[model samples]
Target chain A: MAKHVLRVVAVVYVLFLLVLPVALIVWRTFGDGLAPFAEALTSPSALHAFTVTLTVAGWAVLANTVFGVGAALLLVRHEFPGKRLLGAFIDLPMAVSPVVVGLALILVYGRFSPLGGLLESWGIQVIFSTPGMVLATVFVSLPLVVRAVVPVLEELGDEQEQAAHTLGASRLQSFVRITLPGIRWALGYGVVLCLARSLGEYGAVAVVSGRLVDQTQTLTLFVEERFQNFDQPAAFAAATALALIAVVTLLFTKLLRPKDRSDGN
Target chain B: MAIEVRDVNKSFGTTPVLHDVSLDVAAGSLTALLGPSGGGKSTLLRVIAGLERPDTGTVRISGVDATRLSPQRRNVGFVFQHYAAFKHLTVFRNVAFGLEIRKRPKDEIRKRVMELLELVHLEKLADRYPSQLSGGQRQRMALARALAVEPQVLLLDEPFGALDAQVRKELRTWLRRLHDEVHVTTVFVTHDQEEAIEVADTIVVLAGGEVVQAGSPGEVYDNPANPFVMRFLGPVTEIGGSLVRPHDIEISPDPVEGGSPAVVSRVVRLGFEVRVEVEIGGHEAWVQVTREQADRLGLGPGDTVHLRPAPGARSLVLAL
Candidate 1:
């Protein structure tokens, strides 16, 4: 009787924490006879939101990939003063709220700021625009890629690269042919995480995106807007699309996970 | 080409790793840098290969001033203790890597890689990655990869240090034969005396980041540079303020001219010979005698025996 009660309690916790939320979301998405889902997929506003979200997330991931790998290499291979402090700062984004990231960007890019005036004088808008969305996404998702990659790079010693150098390969050749392949799996996983985090980001993007419908709104913002307007079917449909993307990304990540030792060779 | 290292010094933080070390390696000969652990043998090899730069002085290879050149420009090949094979590449590709980087033709690379694989007797396993190979096989692959580039100088940093005893023995003989065939100026780092004596044309004994002695294997064995080399090389027993190798001492029952009489402390059967420990002048010394000698002397653990220092011993006297 005691074992049965323990089992019941454990299952009840799981149901409340996981299964119930998923079921509620799925049921809400399907309640409108599939017409609302079709409309949401073809709507101009929905299409614009999808495009903006993808473009910002893609740009943010591209920037982070280059910078993250560079930072990882620096942290792993070389030593300088305050290196640990720099590493800690990289993880600062993970601890802060996304809304605070947006607010910080606003402070730096607002019209009255020095850089913001220089950009405005050149007729280049940054705040409350598509670029601001990218800035916010980068700020919030910076740690995801770096944290995923630094440990792998550190574990990989310089022996192989030095071996290549002694074998008469130039510095660039050694890096491209040997070092890149050694860290490719980790870099790929970091990219995926950066993409996922950027796609789902809300608070920072919300503050900076300015809720400009059909202009700078992202999929997450579109879902929130539809739900607040009592358009439950459209909101659920958009959220379901995001859920599909996340599932596919997760499956790809699983496949990319480092293989067991025996099967790798 | 000959390698001449002059007044080389290196330091890791404040701890000195190499201290004003200089050595000459004649071209087309296999040399062994023999030393105990933490003796800076590997550091010297790295300096020679241009993998680690010396804090001061110069390294010249083939009479060329190569002190400032990087490892790639130095045209050296190194085999690490851990094999250091590219785990992602196949055996054939790993061998072809140096050639491929040189932009060799595909057909030439294939032919050369196949030849190297056959040289190491791993041609059948050419497609296998390093992770799929046995420890001994992976070491052979590492050798093939290093040999693929036809390096002007080859540096091996404890190449067989990771192998099992049986495998190490087999590889050592094979390596000696391969060195004979290649005839490259090679320096192999090893702390194992037997391996160095068996494989190297010249043995450079290092101790405490300095060269203690350099000579032919038999020369060093017969006459050590100092007590350190003697103790490092073979079993040593001290007698009358001097250390003596067990095999060098002679034992006799009858008192002979120019010999010391001592009591036998113990007899140890060492498969090849019986090691007889004798106490002479308040110091204990070991003497190796054959079964015939033991029988003739009627020697056992608690008997009296006469000992003598063999002539032509003390080939090299090291500063204390």
Candidate 2:
């Protein structure tokens, strides 16, 4: 009886905390009609905001994939001085608040900073630009891929790679043929996590984007702008779209990622 | 190819793993590096395969100095203890991986892979992934994959160490037959004395990062160079000033002149032979007798018996 009551309580908690809110947003989004939602989605600024969000997320995922796999391989395979320090640094983005991460990036790349000023003198702009938003998103999502990949790499020791090398396969050939296939599932899952984190990132992107309309605004920022301007329908519509994307990504990842066999066979 | 390893030494951090180890494996001969755990057998195998670099040594393969060459350039086949097959690939593809990397023609690769699959007797399971195979089957696949590259020297690091007892026995016999058929210069590491004696043409015994003895199986068993080799190969009993093997001791119910009188302390019945423990000269000594002989003698615990070293029995007296 106690177990039954506990299960009921957990279900009710999830329904209230997650299901109800999403249901309310979806109802509010299309409650009046599809006309307002369509109008908000088709608006030039709204379209640009979605475009910027996706572009920045795309670039962030790409960069994070390369850097994350490299870092994971290094941490798992090699021993060096300051290796633990480097490992701790990989998790820094996860521990620090995204807003703080944004502030830190600004301090390093702002117009007043030495590197930023030099770039500005060369007719380049990073702060308050698309590149700034990408940098912030990458910083926020950096840990996701590395954390996912490191354990898998550690589980797969150097035996298969060594076998390949002894079998007359070159280093690159061995990695491509043996090592990569062995870790493909982990790498794919890491990429999906990086994409999800990059897509929904708002705190760091908001601080670095400068809230410029149609120029640096993302979907989350656009929703906030609409809500502050008393455009409730537009806000709910944008939120609903973002929620739909997240749900689709979740479902896709669940369906396509390799099954987690406990035996590791 | 003939392998000549000269004065190989290796150390991990501050601890030495391989001492100044030198060995020569003739072409078309199977050599077993037999030792206990952490005895540097695997390290020496890796050094010969070019999977590991000795800190200060030279490795010559087929009369060529291969010390500076990488593993790929050395052209050696190495089988790991755990059967490191590519998990994602089917049996056919796993065996064909080396050929694929070498850019062999597709049909030729297919032909060669199928031939190897037939050789390992896994032709019906060609499309199956490694995860679906049994432990012995997976090891066979690993062997086939190693042989796919047609390497000059074949090195196996305890290839049968991970299998069950029955499967290990079966594979040991199969490996002997395979070596006879292929005749590649093969070097394998194992800690099992019986396996080494059964499969290797030459047995190299290592202990504490040093080679204790290297000789033919019969030579080593019959005439051990030291107490370590004698005790390592089989049970040994020290009588007076010499080491005697258990099989060399003869036990009888009646006391014979000039023979030692002892009390039978224990009797352990093995399948073909019975091991009888007797106290002789205030020391426990083991004597192996056939079951028929034991029954005829009626020897059991707490029985009076006479123990004597058989005539022409080999015994060794070592300094250390």
Local distance difference test values of all predictions, in order: 0.87, 0.89
Clashing pairs in 1: B223-B315, B225-B318
In model 2, the clashing pairs are none
- Model 1 / residue B128 / CA error / Å: 0.4
Which residue segments of model 2 deviate by more than 4 Å? A256-258, A262-265, B253-258, B318-320
Largest DockQ belongs to which candidate? Answer: 1
TM-score of each model, in listed order:
0.95, 0.97
Residue A44, model 1, lDDT: 94
Most TM-score-accurate candidate: 2
Q: Summarize candidate 1's per-residue lDDT along A164-199 as a digit string, tens digits.
A: 998889889988988887777888888898898889
Q: Return the number of clashes found in candidate 2.
A: 0
lDDT measured at residue A104 in model 2 versus the true structure, 0 to 100: 85
lDDT of 1 by residue, B1-320 (tens): 48999999999999898988999999998999999999999999999999899999899999999999999988888999998888778998899999999999999999999998998999999999888899999989988898889988989999999999999999999999998988888999999999999999999998888998989898787778788898888777765456777666767787977778899988887776887878887877788888777767777777887777667545233234
Candidate 1 residues lying further than 4 Å off, grouped into runs, are A1-8, A258-263, B315-320
Q: Interface RMSD in Å per candidate, to 1 decimal? A: 1.5, 2.3
For candidate 1, what is the TM-score? 0.95
The DockQ value obtained for model 2 is: 0.64
